[model samples]
Target: MSAAITDGAVKALISQLGYSSLYPPQEMAVKSGILEYERILVTTPTASGKTLIAMMAILKAVEKGMKAVYLTPLRALASEKYDDLKILEKLDLGGSKIRVTVATTDYDSSGNELAGADVIVLTNEKMDTLFRHNAEWLGNVGIFVSDEVHLIGDRERGPTLEMMLTKIRRNYPQSQVVALSATVANSDEIADWLGCKLVESDWRPTKLVEGVYEYGAVKMSDGSKFKVESSGVSSAVDLAIDSFNGGGQALIFAETRKRAASLAAKAVDGVYKRLDKAARELAAGASADILARGDDSELTKTLAQLVAKGVAFHHKGIIKILTATPTLAAGVNLPARRVVIASILRYDSDYGGSVPISVLEYKQLCGRAGRPKYDAFGEAVIVSERGVNAEELYDHYVLGSPEPLRSQLSNDSAIRFHLLSAIATMPGMKKPEIHDLFAGTLFARQYRSATV
Candidate 1:
């Protein structure tokens, strides 16, 4: 209710939720002389009070009677965060006066309108393009929150985020920016872009241990090596099943639907293996077994019989298996005890075959470790077969510091599109200002390194 959040206010918010006091980074965030700040990037490990910090910023704006926009990279992420923010809204203000509205990028916003809300949640593509398309309404926005700010490193999607940030600042110079990101390699650079502060930390409630497992080659420190046990199911599926049996959840990352489905089928195989055979024979049990096992692939049928007893997989194709996954694996909190990567090589070339994953992609997938209540600690073990050289790819990139974030504006088309958006959003702003803002981006930092 106060213009500035007091320690008591902060304490009251945390106490009301029955959560412990804030983390050091969060405490610092709440008190950061934000009015003087234009853009702020909070870089912390997963589950490190990012949502709360984002809320504090939004609430501050709302208290001042200004509408704020929360942007995420994925539609599911937008929904998940929106739903969670709604709970806070109810707790703080009671009744759905509709303080928050979520606009999914892929879906229609027929039921709700973001144009008239205290807060709006949307994916980058939606709000970015929308503001560019309609510049008049940009004047009402007082705050903007960008979640997963580290995504600026993504060559494919980074332009949208960079353009959006530039668009807002150019459109409404007074609007405060709050960019939330996981622990990234270049937080300070991003902070400098928006002319805001950088709050960086490597703190996590849970510790993650990452390693490469060459099927039967390396032991898991206990001298017991994990065999790939290729179930004809993808390695990711196999790993998930192993985790569920060990009383843990897993998040498997797959780029393509086929890969996701194939990997999920493998996990479902393990689920099938665990079902009680006799229970599965009962009509309900049989149906459950059949559903879990999926098709009558002789091997699948046998796997289903095993599943009749208890096991299952998750991916796009296996509807039964998908139930076990986080549709939005990044921000979603369903932690898997063992998270696996199906394909590190994502893009295909007509002549060159497949392109290896960028460091950012690998980090995002690996960050799925230790999903909250599921495990005290999480394991991000890359699975490869014996004598297979794929392990080296991970060792050199994933297990190491990610390749530096790069600037996507290097592409003339990207620069031109951003230039158009900048003209629309921040009319009369000099071209030099656009370059500075874009250069302040993580993309520009990486681009500089590449050229150097």
Candidate 2:
């Protein structure tokens, strides 16, 4: 059982919650001395107990009377982790209660408020804003856990995480940073940046079967093929129907909001036929709730109707529902027995045309397929369309490795903002200090020839 390997009090708490064994990656993480000051970068698949590694380190930090911070990429994920960590309040840390608090979009926490809590959860941006404002609580933390650490490669938001990490390592050098990330190709590079031990694994609790759907048949990566009863429907719709007929829920990811809604509406009839009376009533209630939001648009109505039949779609523009989207794939925990990639391309306004999504993004969507303990094996199928061939999709997505995590810290705008914030927040901070700080970033490590 995990209790024999985990900390005593932490073991008791986790055992009380029915968690007794450790996953392979989690066991490697705990054995790597993460709870004893060794920094660690965990790059593994989704639902692989990455968070448990963080929890073990956090409990260790709290046991030692040190504060810990849990940083997430999204507010929703922050809340989810906060709720999960709330159980730590019952952990008898030598008779002291562990104060767990969340600072997200809801309210900004003052230095004193954050300092008082044993564990503080925040979105990366929110945590960065707090640091910019010179929150005193940021300095006292001894453990900093970053979930979805692979986002450091994202251009728009990756810079903030990169800069925040640089600042954290510069300012709070003593803190133990446990970075949890999706499996990336260049995990060693990230570990080098954090100066941490690397733990990478392809182990998953549930088997994952990835493939491509074309001409009403799914060609699996393992060389197996299954005929789908799509009967004139797109491969995406056919896959969903096959999953439902097999008594499993399907999560379909579409590129556009309109396409997502249409697919959901199209899949509803197929999904409804397999639903029993109880499921039908539950789906109907959920659908009514979606419609009650009072958006009389046809898309909303279609979305609601689909939900009534036990199928739903998700996109940023549509109302938040239990469904599929790139955003959902990244931040939320809505799993399905099968995951369908409706499109591999999205309209990029910056490029003025549709562009193929990165391998990392597609992998995240595929990660949404297996629900641990519930599904024996999960299926992730990519639907091929015009201009995109089935063989190409299989090679590019089903068997491709995720892109490496590159720091976005060198952008002129990011440097300008962070430098200004550093000078303003740190008392008597000199130009030399700024130079030294930026020089220590992953950007500096990657581009040794360039001057920060």
Candidate 3:
């Protein structure tokens, strides 16, 4: 154990959280003086104690009579993190009670209700809106924790996240920043941009085995092989059945919501057949609960029917198999014993045809495999499509490294929106001031100020 972990408050918090000792990543963070206000970027595998590292930093901030803010890209993730951090409210830090709050709606307000909170969790957009509103309480925050920091590469939401970090680093230089991200190829660059120490690791609690499925056989990276009995429906459903028979749950990822729902509907019969009496009764109870909500729409009725048979689509619950679109891969901690990728290609409007998914996206989906404690090893299989070379698919998705993190701030709409936001926030700012503001961004750091 490090000096930071053995300290009084941290040790007590760890005991309360039921952790016997810090994992390797967490231990490395503590050794880097994270609790003493060190800025750090931790890039590690999923379920690798990254959240604990952030929690430790938040605890230190709260103990100092200052506030800590946690930022996520999605509302669902914000809710999940809020629920996780709520446990800290039970701990007494420096004789003051911890107050935790979450804000994901009403971005137009100044969020005065969050003024007294010791720890606040929010979606990235909400935090940006507060900055735009000039929320006075934000100046008192001692630490800012950004979860899933790798999303800065996304085309849709990445610009807002990049601008948020740029503003925080430039405006609040005194505050500590603890960035948490999945393992990416260019994490060192991101760390350099944040001026933080880089803590990268591949260590995970449960081993992950990557594989490719073709012709009813799955070839694993660890030199193992298994034949999935054909359910004559789909390879994904067959893989789900194989996983259930081996006494584990399966999560299948489809390219689209429609495909996910179709696969889940097809999987109901096979999953229900494998369920024991107790599981079947539980599934029926879940189905009844869904019906009790009284949506009565066709989609809800179909989902309720699927739940009764131990299957579901696009939502998390007690079920044997869950099929979801790639959106589920974004920082949602729904781990399973087996993860089957139904398709590696998705339709793209810009390209005017189907395009292969990026290696980073594939890795994100693979991270969901291997339930911690329940499965000794989790399997991630990419199904081979017709006319596509299986060897090529395996080489690119399973064996290749994930893509580097790049900034999307250069997009035309993003540039216009953020520049106007800067003008509105600063009021009477000049061109040089605007240049200086954006020059602090990761995009400017990567491409130089001339581009900005």
TM for every model, in the order presented, reads 0.77, 0.91, 0.98
- What is the lDDT for 55 in model 1? 75
Which candidate number has the best lDDT?
A: 3
Show pairs that collide, candidate 2. Answer: 2-20
Top TM-score model: 3
Whole-model alpha-carbon lDDT for candidate 2? 0.80
For model 2, the run of ten residues with the poorest summed lDDT:
315-324
Whole-model lDDT values for every prediction:
0.63, 0.80, 0.90
Q: Candidate 1's C-alpha lDDT?
A: 0.63
Ranking by lDDT: 3, 2, 1
| Candidate 3 TM-score to native | 0.98
Candidate 1, residues 1-452, lDDT tens digits: the string is 33345644344556665565667667667567544343677888777778888876776676666888889988778888898777546534333343788876643233234567788888888877576556344577788998887777666678888777766766678889888877577666667766778887878767776655554333342334555554664556666666665766666666665555455445554665554545345524544547565675765564443333333333222222232332345566545566666556655554367566666656666677885654688777666644547557556644577555566767777777777766765688796776766654445555663331
Q: What are the per-residue Cα lDDT tens digits for candidate 2 across 42-96?
A: 9988888887789889988888878899999988788889998998887786778
The deviation in Å at residue 25 for candidate 1 is 3.2
